[model samples]
Target: MKVDGEVTTGLGKAAYFLSQEFYTKEFEKNLGFIPYPGTLNVIVSDEYLDEINEIKCNCENLIKPDEGFGAVRYIEAKLNDVIVGAIVFPAKTTHDENYLEFIAECKLRDELDLKDGDIVSLEF
Candidate 1:
């Protein structure tokens, strides 16, 4: 399955959660690399909300959070048809259904030379 979304700025909060040792360790173990200490925020088109939810539902690699933190679920995907990454959904996110969070071994924005309003596609 594939989903496309527009690049958008995030709330500047993902780094806090991603940088935690708990999450970084799990990411390294489950994802085979320690993700960069942040996420690439993308806003999906409304028409694809169902597909996004389906992807969320199919996630099996769940990361249970530490005390006072929310769990995250993710599925492996390819970004821009090349880079391996994971699309993540955090239970405590401020985003609605239209948003998808991507985590990769490196900063995706820099890796892809992306900026706000750029369109990116993810394939699973």
Candidate 2:
């Protein structure tokens, strides 16, 4: 289906295929492993500044991993004057680096049209 100028061929159909064939190969060649699924908080708003602030607030409230292997970072994607998506990274820490998962959840309390907010708890 076409929405605006973008196409949605069903939930994750495009991203899944792209990730498997293109993203995975490219990422592995450039980076390393197939990107693991990580969580992110998506927030959309007209006020970009406020949206950024909200992302910061959410990250501050995020629960840190007990193993000291991961942390949460917020990323905001904007489309023109409107905020599109807010991403939260639950990342793994290496000796001198960090790797974030590829799944995203919500952190905002307001009624925003975004994905659900599910707290991620993992051992590895």
Candidate 3:
């Protein structure tokens, strides 16, 4: 499926490959398995287009996955410096399943104002 959004910083060939590899490894480490082999579609939002552009221009690099199954495709949208919203592409076969869980977790985190190093475990 084609996911359409605003144009953010265009990723280079090497960056794209590295990002894919990093996500693959992170998924295995976190879930004790690899994602279902499939081509995942990522859409970058226009809201963070300028920020992404600035980062690329200055650093010549994009933010990579942070040692997890979920990776930010593009900032999607932001409120101030905080990432209020984003589009994450997981290698899982069903994107909705992962997305729903993400939303639920975000809600809980927001409700409790959870901080870094706090672990939230879900039974699935």
Find the candidate with the highest lDDT and give its number.
1
Candidate 2 on 92-122: residue-level lDDT in tens? 3221112122231222222223334433221
Candidate 2's C-alpha runs over 4 A off are 1-10, 37-41, 49-115, 118-124
The residue ranges of model 1 lying beyond 4 angstroms of the native Cα positions read none
What TM-score would every model get versus the actual structure?
0.95, 0.26, 0.22
Q: What ordering of candidates by lDDT runs from best to worst?
A: 1, 3, 2
Residue-wise C-alpha lDDT for candidate 1, range 1-124, written one tens digit per residue: 8888899999999999999998999989988999998999989889988877877888788999889999999888898999998989998988878988999999988888999999999887
Clashing residue pairs found in predicted model 3: none
> Which is the winner by lDDT between candidate 1 and candidate 3?
1
Each prediction's RMSD to truth? 1.0, 15.4, 14.0
Which candidate wins on TM-score? 1
lDDT of 2 at 54: 50
